[model samples]
Target: MSCKVIDTHSQLAYVVRMIHCVCNNINTAKVDAAAARGAESAACVQRACGTKFNCGQCREDINHRLAAWRALNPMLEAAE
Candidate 1:
């Protein structure tokens, strides 16, 4: 039998699915789109994605993704 080794610390193992606002059927793609379209804040994301103020569980997570996405793609920011 051949021995196979798996890397527990691999980056793929740490990959996380971005699910923002499940109640409103929103996902990472939607959030990214919104962020790219000038959603610099969670409130803006909620509004743009029609999430509104539901259970409020996704609020923090959305904000986090927004900040990260913006940091990575600085050019997506809308001109003020």
Candidate 2:
């Protein structure tokens, strides 16, 4: 008998703290923070927060969320 085993990547098992802006269960807060930290990359936030890009379909919303978050976190931006 032969058995094949599959492992889940640590990077992929991330759940961001998102709020459903459209009531579609989309986490915006997390996306925004991640974007501010990494922008297009988002990898840094992904690693730190363990939030996978599961919502690729929500790119537009993500962008919007990022902008809103930046506006809210002006001090964070200046510090960075």
Candidate 3:
């Protein structure tokens, strides 16, 4: 039997902190924190982080992050 090798670079890329909002300098950690604080929308997340949309390009990524957060917290979704 042969052993399998993992692509460490790809794994590292996946674990790296991403800048979800380049304009506001907001990263995934900030988005996650906002989601934990009950921010249901991108605007709410930005507001919670003391920022706002400038170019609107980050909306999709922010929404994606919010969706992931919601998926992980089903009880919070039920409460909302």
Candidate 4:
């Protein structure tokens, strides 16, 4: 017999979706997708996500997400 074990905790961490923009219901996945699609600024990310800043509190978080995305995608940053 063979047994397999799954690390749900670690797997859940990767699958977890964080709400970065409460005003527009934007999540980290959306932000990353926008970044992957050439969104260099928060405004670009908002536009790509089909929404705009309302309260504006999420701007900084969006920027952070963009920065993290850029870090992961160094080639995109180098090309820019």
Candidate 5:
């Protein structure tokens, strides 16, 4: 038998809080933080989080999280 965990942030398995880069122990929260701070691209997120590409598996996931973060915090800039 097998069981799967669901994150409260999303019904989808790809929620950003899930680990995105095992190589650097980077999760969606870190990526989203970077995006919230104006890191516009995946490379920016990587740089902000002090992580590097290892297996290249996380690039797409990071990008997805970045977009979501931007959408969630669109008003963040106005408060700054």
Candidate 6:
């Protein structure tokens, strides 16, 4: 077998899927779009798209991804 190595300490945002909270259609891009449009609340997304959240398996991952994404794009505060 070939050996492969990756640096785990380094963080990255892997937006594997668009986060469409069924209660709201809040996808990954919406957060940025919302911020661009001057929205700071996840609820605003909920109000707009019904992405209020459900099972939450994705919640922790979403939060972490949002943080990772934000770290890379530091000018925007995460709307999570």
Write one digit per residue (lDDT tens) for candidate 4, span 16-78.
Answer: 689999999999899889988899888998999889899999999889888877877799778
Candidate 6: pairs in clash = 23-50, 23-51, 24-49, 24-50, 24-51, 25-49
The residue-by-residue lDDT of candidate 2 on 1-80, one tens digit each, is 99987776533323445563333344655566566675643344444356555645554655555666666667887777
lDDT of 6 by residue, 1-43 (tens): 9999978745333343466454445667765455445443555
Query: What is candidate 6's local distance difference test score?
Result: 0.52
lDDT of each: 0.74, 0.54, 0.85, 0.85, 0.76, 0.52
| Winner on lDDT (1 vs 5) | 5
Once model 3 is optimally superposed onto the true structure by TM-score, how far is the C-alpha of residue 78 displaced, in angstroms? 3.8
After TM-score superposition, the amount by which residue 45's alpha carbon in candidate 5 deviates from its true location, in angstroms, is: 1.0
Stretches > 4 Å off in candidate 2: 1-26, 32-55
Steric clash count of candidate 4: 0
Clashes (backbone N, CA, C under 3 Å), per candidate, total: 0, 3, 0, 0, 0, 6
Q: TM-scores across all candidates?
A: 0.68, 0.43, 0.73, 0.74, 0.70, 0.42
Residue pairs of candidate 5 with colliding backbone atoms: none
RMSD to the hidden true structure, all candidates: 6.3, 13.9, 3.9, 5.4, 7.7, 6.4
Best by TM-score: 4
User: In model 4, which runs have C-alpha deviations exceeding 4 angstroms?
Assistant: 1-16
Kindly state the number of residue pairs that clash in model 1: 0
Q: What does the lDDT come to for candidate 1?
A: 0.74
Against the correct fold, how does model 2 do in TM-score?
0.43
Q: Is candidate 4 or candidate 6 better by lDDT?
A: 4
Off by over 4 Å in 5: 1-16, 77-80
- Expressed as tens digits, the lDDT of each residue in 9-73 for candidate 3 is 74343356799999999998898889888898899989999988999899998998889777767
* Candidate 1 C-alpha lDDT tens digits along 1-80: 99999867544322455577877877777778888788877778888977686888888988888877766666655443
What's the C-alpha lDDT at position 80 in model 3? 68
Cα lDDT tens digits, model 5, 1-80, are: 89998767553433525887888888877887887788877778888988778787888888887777766667885566
